[model samples]
Target: MGFDEVIPAPGRAWWSPVDQGAFVLDPGTVLHAGPGTERVAHWLRSTVGAATGLLLAEGRGDHGIELGLDPGLGPEAYRLDVTGQGIRVRGGDPAGVFWGAQTLRQLLGPEAFRRAPVDPGRREWPVPLGTVEDRPRFRWRGLMLDVARHFMPKDGVLRYLDLMAAHKLNVLHLHLTDDQGWRIEIRKYPRLTETGSWRSRTKFGHRASPLWEEKPHGGHYTQDDIREIVAYAAERHITVVPEIDIPGHSQAAIAAYPELGNTDVIDTASLTVWDTWGISPNVLAPTDNTLRFYEGVFEELLELFPSEFVHVGGDECPKEQWRQSPVAQARIKELGLADEDGLQAWFIAHFDKWLSARGRRLIGWDEILEGGLAKGAAVSSWRGYAGGIAAARAGHDVVMCPEQHVYLDHRQAPGEDEPVPIGYVRTLEDVYRFEPVPPELTEPEARHVLGTQANVWTEVMEDPARVDYQVFPRLSAFAEVAWSHLPAPREREFIGFQRRMVAHYARLDALGVAYRPHTGPRPWQRRPGVLGRPLEGPPPNR
Candidate 1:
């Protein structure tokens, strides 16, 4: 009866009387799919069959489930009605049908989450009669993975995609390049992956002020691999937004080809894939070569990722190197720019023009606002909400991922035991309480606020298991914040949501999600790379 029973609590839902009866699914049950919902029906057929050992057929039938498109429904919205006679889902679009399928899976039970060995005879799942009308509160429900910090393999990425899709998050922002490594292959620059992907060692900073592992560490995603990744995410109705960090976090690129940097200012060979943390002063110099290099890189990226938005990191870029370079200074005066910040804008605008030509939108960190953001660029406000507020006021679309709220790397709790020992505490409650559209914005201004995201920076994370522990539960809580409308003063609401998680946690367990236990982290959960202590901020990306 109470809506608190739902995770990501559906926009609207209600229970029906048991006398109304329930639909008993069997091998012979037909999954009738309407136009534009065939793919979703197919997925549902496969999913349900796998979970319960029922060979449900996909076809029109008198007594069975139905997936249909409702022309009147809005974007990513769906309505589900269930009765003993049958169950029916009407969606606004293909995507809406997919979400409806997800909701149906939840309704079916935890068994719907996994493909276990079914008994030979067959099994029947009885679904409770109910009605749910749902739609997302925001279009850009997203989750970001900084694979550049610690290269997550292809399967690892896929697993996250499955998890995200299950939670109804639509965007998977891949931070592909950083000072530590460049994870995507650029055919034009083979060395970007060949040389830039490998580091002589990793800095532990445990034994000494700075320690290095003698072991060489490296990995990369080939063009084919990226293609496969794109196709896989597409099947799940998720968009993969690729990031190629420029200017700043260019140590990897500079390591591959020193000419991309200010060789006039510093020794070119000194630039190696950074092993230690901190922003490297090494950055791509404002030269024809640097511009052409990125153009080539994006040329490859454009072919790989077709998402409307592409992230070109413009955050935490130090201007010291640009100020000192004679070439940089001369170029500044040549362009009639006031300072280094303007030069950085030149870099962003170059790509802005390039992506726009390809009919894609440029997404940059809040720093793109320093000199001036390019005309069509969408701003990702990570530093804080003020950047999003500013960008929205300026009529630019903004994504809210303020570190204080949505950064998952931040310790979930305080004291010595919190791993990744960085960032101030940002708990599940903090994330759930965050509103994507800032209060400072007027109604018109608020429209520019697309949505928000939870960032999982893998600076200290080395494997997929740790990623799960850090992301789940909190991610689950944030999903509700992004999808469901909150009643004013949501404290009591959170308590209700927390209760809902008891069932969700069981679902996660059945699906083999190594979520952090309600108690605390296990000993092995803190692997060699991470410890129980807390970390604040990142190792200098300076």
Candidate 2:
């Protein structure tokens, strides 16, 4: 592989030809980690060492790999120098060291991504002599995984964490709750899992499809599972941002605790965990008891996820129930809220203050901007860039996750063979060319653009393999968009990206990722007849 072949392309890199010789890793080579870099060293030994059949035991030998910290570099910046003498990795911080290690694995070739050495008899692994200096272009390179719609087991979530790290993505926004199911165990609310985690059946494809997966479908992560996930991600320098839908997309929560719903408006007790897709009208009532219950849930959540931002899904919440309920109407009047929109805002603002007081920040979907947002609140602009632009201009931090661009669950191609396609056709190139920070924003406004994230909504993704098919390749491109400082979106060289992908694909293969091939889905990857809701007009730009 050439020195320039790094994905999420490094800031700068150069290499000497093979005629100059290369650094070779064999059973004799050791790993030496300086202060503050023990974690990264351990990871390299456990992951790369196992893959290459090298011991990489702790030592300070002349032919050893050295890990050190350089405070002068950017927090996520790293410098890697590989020569015949040895390999040296220095980072601004532990996270930077870890990222450099990821690049090192890439340099070692695809075989380094495997679980175990492919050829036990072959002992040496050669890394071309080179110098690579790199850092992320954005702080919040993220992937929002919706585990609620089609419950992914604990191991599946862990697997995704590894995948995110592989692409230099640092945030795992775990959408833990939605109308279809709740995937986190709340000890105070045991029924959330017992009653709300499963559905009687699931709509096989799009809601329009006349298909059904006529079997129970649901599972949740126990509190211990959550702790493990958070700890594991922290080891990789990835934060697990847990999302709990509020007001809307919360039928499952209401299903478990009828008292949390607007009981006066509907027999909320009659609601089971929603078995189908789409926003649900059974929203949480705007009552003190409802607030108290979620507060308890958040209290436990905070103990598990120490991430700075808590994502309270404030998008697509239908207000019909709030409009019809006498109790909701009286509460609105009592609070002097002008309308249901104001009530929704009031609910979000309450949590904003609550979370802020506890030294955490609140982040929600763009709808949280409807009435007004607290000064500390951030926005996940999913509808389009308009929300992100508005939020950024208003001095609110923004994560540009506009569905039109980075919705990985959308079909990669317009071909009929694509599996359960949804939304606009966002091919790999579309993602590679996606520009998260809109040019319209002023410099100050653009600073609020925390970064970008690709959201994988699982309405159509039924299993881990399906999730993999939708996320890879495009996610690889998205990673570049998030990490690299490339030319303008239109000017990005897709042809060069395709060339780099030739290597990345082999890495993905070694990692056992079931990604959609560049040539389109393989036979089994296609779902011939399953219907999809494909938009027909020009793709939305805002």
Candidate 3:
């Protein structure tokens, strides 16, 4: 494949023909590492070498692949030059060199993505002579994976990290908690996992569906498991942002400890881990005890995740509970809050200040903007661009992931064949055309647009395969949207992108991704009789 065919399309590239003779990676090929590139050298030796079955011994021999750093390039920019003589990969920093290494692997063919070489005895791996100078359009190219609705084991999460790295995506927002389940262990709150992790049954499809799976479902990552996940992602230059939904989507936590809920408004002790989808009215009580309880949870959480930004879910919270509870009313009156919205904002503000005090920043859903945004909070604008625009203009950072464009759980096509089709139909091309920075923002305001993220909500996705079917192919498009410098949404050259996907499909297959084929889902991939919540009209962007 030529450089033009690379996914997320390189910023600039020049390729030579096969007749010029391909540079072969033989048994004798050595790997040379320069200053500040030890990590990349190790990654090349371990990851690429393991996949290609080459020793790639450490040395400075002639015709060896060299990895080095260039002080002039951007931190995430890299330059690759390959010829019959040898290959040179250089970047401004370690991350750039690592991304360059990813491109090198891509050049070696689909087999380079495998865990082990298909032909163990074969040593020669040829790559065409070419030069690529590339850098990302956005620093925070991310994917938010919701594992609360349906748990993915640690290994699956690792696989996704690898996938994200392959596409030059650098952020993994792990939604660890929600109304349905809690997927992270807190030592201070042992029962969160013991009682809140498992649900008695699960909604088969949408919350409105009549079907139910009458079986237990739950899982949580141990502290060591989380440490491993963080280290694994760090190796690939990816950040794992942990999301702990607060105030709202805390039924699981409340189920673990009834005191965390509004006892006056509801029978908190009688509640169980949520068995269905959609918003839950069982929000946390706006009390000092609730604050202290979550503060303890965050104290342990900060130890596990060291990312600069911590997500406190500030979305879809119901006010009916606070409206009905005298305790909540007293708290609101005591704090001089306007109403329940102000209370929700106050809840988020507490954490924002708490996190800021510990040298970390707070990020939450756009709903956090309703009452009064905290001083040091970022917005994950999921509903649409309006929140993002407002946040940016107000000098707050924003990650545009409007549901109309990047919600992967939404059906890929308009048909019953799509598995548990949810929300709007957002096809692959639609994602490719998604522009993160809105035109309404002035140049200065646009700087607050940190980057873009594609959300994968697992409410209807029961297992990894179903998640794969919904995410991939379209994720490829979203990756380009985040990384590549492209024209306006309507002017993007999707036909060219489709051509590039032809080669990427082979790579996905080699990596064991059960992505929905471009034409449509494979017969086995379809959920025949499952119900879905498909809206009648198209999204505004469409």
Candidate 4:
């Protein structure tokens, strides 16, 4: 295999056996700095120390390790050259350099991911002889964390960020608000968390047999928590994109502030935090007050996340309330809009204008394309690539997260029971075969396809371990799909990629990730309703 030590296979790389020779890292190794690489050096030292319990010394030297800047390499690209004498890594920017360091850790073997002190007999980590010239194929390699459905703590979020960075994934799209809960702290809206972040009980069990987790469930990240998470992600060159879902998933918010909902049609005073799943008819009323309330929320969001695009959830919005509300109908007539879809479009357009004024672009679910798409709105195509193809054709940016192929919440296999079983089966190969830009899009239209990401909706997932089980291995394949450019569907091969996973899994083990094994689920994991059926043909929703 050509330079087999890396995942998201490098673009250009070569490796050869050097007859019992390797770059052995030990306590005596010296880290030489390049401009803007002090942090990089420190990271390397900390990582090495964590794995081997030996701190590496830093100074100017002929070489132990060297980090250099190479402006010509372009952005998010790097070159790692390993020789018998030492190792040298060059990147176009700090992000590129950080990726290289992550790769270097992989090269050092699985033990490199461990935090345990070094063994008495093992004092060094060896990297094979090789050079890797690498860069990502797509700019928006990302993963979505749905903290709204079932809140994940700040620590878990940070851990997942580390894993994303290890795979060189650049974006962390945090689904922070939904009918189930609102997960971000807004100073002006304390009630949003105090009342909305919690639900009386949870709807659990299969569709045929329903049950409830009678205990109250809730959690929210404070402003300070968000600030720390953002900084941590920034240090690893990962951008945390916060999604404060609105319009449809606003039941929680409406529960906190009754005025935010359609009090004219729905009983706002009786609106409790949504206790179940699926689309909620309790959407944000298309009114000035609701608009002003969200603007204040976005003010806090924009300050927290430096991401250029903010996701305003515009999907699964039931029009029952809109169809019954006089205010919504009046807004549609006032704007000369067609129907409920038009009214929803008008609502999104308001935010589009609002966000644009603040130098940010509006991003929302593909449903935003319903009546009319905003001028600069970006679409996250979850239902399928059809929306993405349409959005690209319409000259708008698109992030292809088709539910069929990229939804990590889906069961890994047809018969395997899962902790959080939902959605149709999406195999590792299915994810590996996913290409962000659809074949139907022309070159010009394809330019609008920024890239793609996998989403982990946590309706059934109750803990970090469950999230780990649902997202991994498949996440690994997806990393390659987003970062490495292989041939089209039938032509692309994954055997080598599979081979590399053998070692990568060890790295994950060291990191204490509870990934599912390739052999399939353990016996305890198998159950009737828990095991999802395979998606043989196009899924009904898709």
> Per-residue lDDT for 52-147 in model 3, tens only?
999899887667899999969887999999988889999988999999998888888898888898999897988888899999999999999999
TM-score of 3: 0.97
* Residue 497, candidate 1: C-alpha displacement in angstroms: 0.6
User: For every candidate structure, what is the RMSD over all alpha carbons to the true structure, in angstroms?
Assistant: 2.3, 1.8, 1.9, 2.1
Global CA lDDT computed for model 4: 0.84
Candidate no. 4 TM-score: 0.96
Report the poorest 10 consecutive residues by lDDT, candidate 2.
533-542
Q: Where is model 2 more than 4 Å wrong at Cα? A: 525-529, 537-542
Candidate-wise lDDT, in order:
0.82, 0.90, 0.90, 0.84
lDDT of 4 by residue, 1-542 (tens): 12675888889887766455678777777888799977888888777667776667776565488998898998989999988888999999988888888888888777778766647467776777789999888899999999998889999999998899889999999999999999999999899999999999987633322567789999999999999999999988898888887788889999999999999996898999998777677889889998889999999999999999999988888899989989888888888988898888888888999999999999998999998887799999998889999999999999999998998878787643555445677878888888888889999999999989899888767678778888988999999989887889667787777888888888888888988887886454433444344435433332
- TM-score against native, each model: 0.95, 0.98, 0.97, 0.96
**For each candidate, how many residue pairs have backbone atoms clashing (under 3 Å)?**
12, 1, 0, 0
Off by over 4 Å in 1: 1-4, 17-20, 118-122, 205-209, 489-492, 524-542
Query: Which candidate do you rate higher for lDDT, 2 or 4?
Result: 2
Which of the predicted structures, 3 or 4, would earn the higher lDDT when compared with the native?
A: 3
How do all the candidates rank in terms of lDDT, highest first? 2, 3, 4, 1
* Model 2 whole-model lDDT (C-alpha atoms): 0.90
